[model samples]
Target: MSGERSRTDRTTLLARNDLVFIDFDGTISVTDTGIAVIDALELDEAWEIEHQWRRGEIDSMECLTRQWGMVDLARGAVYRMIDSFELDEGFNELAEAAIQIGAGLVVVSDGLDFYVDRMLGRLGWETCPGEEVIKRPRRCIPRFANHGRVTDHGVEISFPHRSPDCDQCGNCKTAHLQRLRAHFSRVIYIGDGHSDLCAARFADLVFAKDALAEDFAQSGRPFVNFETLAEVNEVLLAPRTR
Candidate 1:
């Protein structure tokens, strides 16, 4: 919960060989920011668009592009709505623990980077704008997500992180995981939705909940079940019995 820690201090303590990739919406935040935006702005058509994405009828890029096009609210109103949402109570604990344990923590989300950066900023985690993190290395909690710009007309969305070979997700969480995994000895993934399924499969350790947990359970894949970030922190920082 200590937001006063400097980025340099935290980065100095980070271990280069270990990393944790987390989902944003339902994992770190108590609610899904995208859905909240749609509902708050009364973008009724966006719901059907979401349903299409859920049914696998459209890729997330098209889905989000369509939904964002439907947005007619003022930029300030949209940002105000985003600021109203709350993060998981235990997220700060998990983040602090990750720094304490020298494990790198990054958020890889399929949602908008605008909101993601705002949310992380609320926790005092410094962030680099847009795809700048990819070009410049920083000691902050890096985020990968679809890019969004608020215009007088509405919100314009773009996919700067989507995989060249894949169209299913806007940000392509799997691609980010694959790239980061090479530099880390162990990679841990924490998520709760469909966007997480692909990346979670490639992780060295997975902590799953909600749809992600259901999918892994149905497939008989191994994963640790968790209900809160606190539980994740406990497991990660616990004394090894072995």
Candidate 2:
């Protein structure tokens, strides 16, 4: 079902008890971190697999598994490359406002935990210092994503959050939001890709961009179009009728 908008035009009322679910890849960062890692490692065949997934010929699990396998770079090398990634300049402002407002912030992604944790840590989102024993955070705004580990042979990819019922995605964002539904009165979602589709539908409010925006447009769901965190904060901080 589509969401009801707040009294203010083009704004939504987010309460203090609301929980915000954010997508990490293309949404927060300028580019898809997973795709950037794949490209950096010169995994040319991964593109073909991605195209197959987009064309509805392959599922997301297969696409991710095959793509990770094609990545032959050493664990250290991979981290070095990922460290160079850049985030949207306005993300910190949005984050600060959310924190100040006492809203829960969570990162839900279909990408690898290693990259997600690393990138978030670079932005000072770590749960605690020296707690990244496995090269991934204990929690990233209490995140959920595919787990990644460095092994003797190469990087091992595992999906602890993969839903057994849904074979389409490695991490079922819909399931994640469903679990959080009872804990918060309102759930807000921010995202920018195909993986964000299921979860975005369940959110009380959505801020979308790139492909996710197109998905929202086709779904006829009420959503805010945001190019930066500044725009997101503008809507988030807007006065509520209730």
List clashing residue pairs in candidate 1: 15-102
- Candidate 2 has its poorest 10 consecutive residues by lDDT at 129-138
TM-score result, candidate 2: 0.85
**lDDT, candidate 1, at 159:** 84
- For model 1, residues 134-211, the per-residue Cα lDDT tens digits are 332344777788999988778899888878978799899888888767666788889999889888999877889999
Models 1 onward score TM values of 0.86, 0.85
Model 1 C-alpha RMSD vs. true structure (Å) is 7.1
Give the per-residue lDDT of model 2 (tens digit) for 35-132.
88767777788889988987768888888888888777776777777889888756666666556666677777888888777887888876332212
Error of 2 at 80 (Å): 1.0
Whole-model lDDT per candidate: 0.78, 0.75
